[model samples]
Target: MCQEQKGFTLWFTGLPCSGKSAVADRVAEILRSRNLKVERLDGDIVRKSLCRDLGFSREHRNENIRRVTFVAKLLTRNGVAVLTSFISPYREIRDEARREIGEFIEVYVKCPLEVCMARDVKGMYQKAIKGEIKEFTGISDPYEEPLQPELVLETDKETLEESAQKVINCLKKLGYLDHNF
Candidate 1:
């Protein structure tokens, strides 16, 4: 039998501009400061590299989720805290991730659509509104959120630090962190 590594995945799922990436970045940094190996894989970054050819089509989105989930499993098996930020948009994909990786925590970064559009840090919402972008979740497409996630973070009102601290606390409580130093 293969030995299990002391690694886990904290998956962040939310609409664009919902603060998933920013909060994941903070949580990963906090975990690393305590000596835990960390790997953050954001959807935008992945699309720019491994999934550069992918489009906004639903089929492509599903494939993107699968690819990211596969990489998350690999990283977790190798003893890295894999933090994945993506607007996964499907319960089926999240379920697959749970089955593939033994330790997967799905965090729903809940933000109102209006709030997300206002933030639009990447200007994706603007492009979608201008009809320049297609199959945009919450605009031209849909984002079916997780039915029951481990944590539902309301980022519209919460500070990124607060959101990150909640995730860190959960990890510490779950023994994913040896101790929150």
Candidate 2:
């Protein structure tokens, strides 16, 4: 008889260009390879769809996360492994999400601001620096780093594969994944 995989939400949080999405994508691929039902909710993609009307202000940002949290909560309860990549810059909002979603893991994608700026391919940092964009985290807005996240992936110091493995290892250690996975 086959065993049902437990559902959980892996919330990736960091500054822009900090490899949150990249690492989440890699982890999602690995989970899928293990035949787990996975769903990725990336900031940019979700902004273009679910949060298209939202802006970068604190209120809007909080609302954006609220919506994502709701979706994640639903998926998690339904046995889907939900991987979300978002700046989610406030500790309070993240804590709220954790409370709302019983099975939640906060994965802090830790990369220095300078490193993130250097990795920017969209010129978002440049625009924010030039005053072309407003309320940009790590530029104008604040990014409240997690006080005690379940996992921390230092993207600048670690290779993508290493970071991805760290997340997988964390899941296993936390009993989210089977030993064979």
Each model's TM-score, in the order given?
0.93, 0.98
Positional deviation of 114 in candidate 1, in angstroms?
0.5
Whole-model alpha-carbon lDDT for candidate 2: 0.95
Clashes of each: 0, 0
Candidate 2 weakest ten by summed lDDT: 172-181
Top candidate on lDDT is 2
lDDT tens string, model 2, 1-181? 8887799999999999999989999999998987899999999899999999999889999999999999999999999999999999999999999999999999999999999999886899999999999999999999999999999999999999999999999999999987777
lDDT of 1 by residue, 1-181 (tens): 9544488999999888898899999998887876778999998799999899888777888889889888999999889999999998878878888999889999999999999999889889999999998888899888888888888899978889899988987887787765634
Cand. 2 TM to true fold: 0.98
Regions of model 2 farther than 4 Å from truth: none
Off by over 4 Å in 1: 1-5
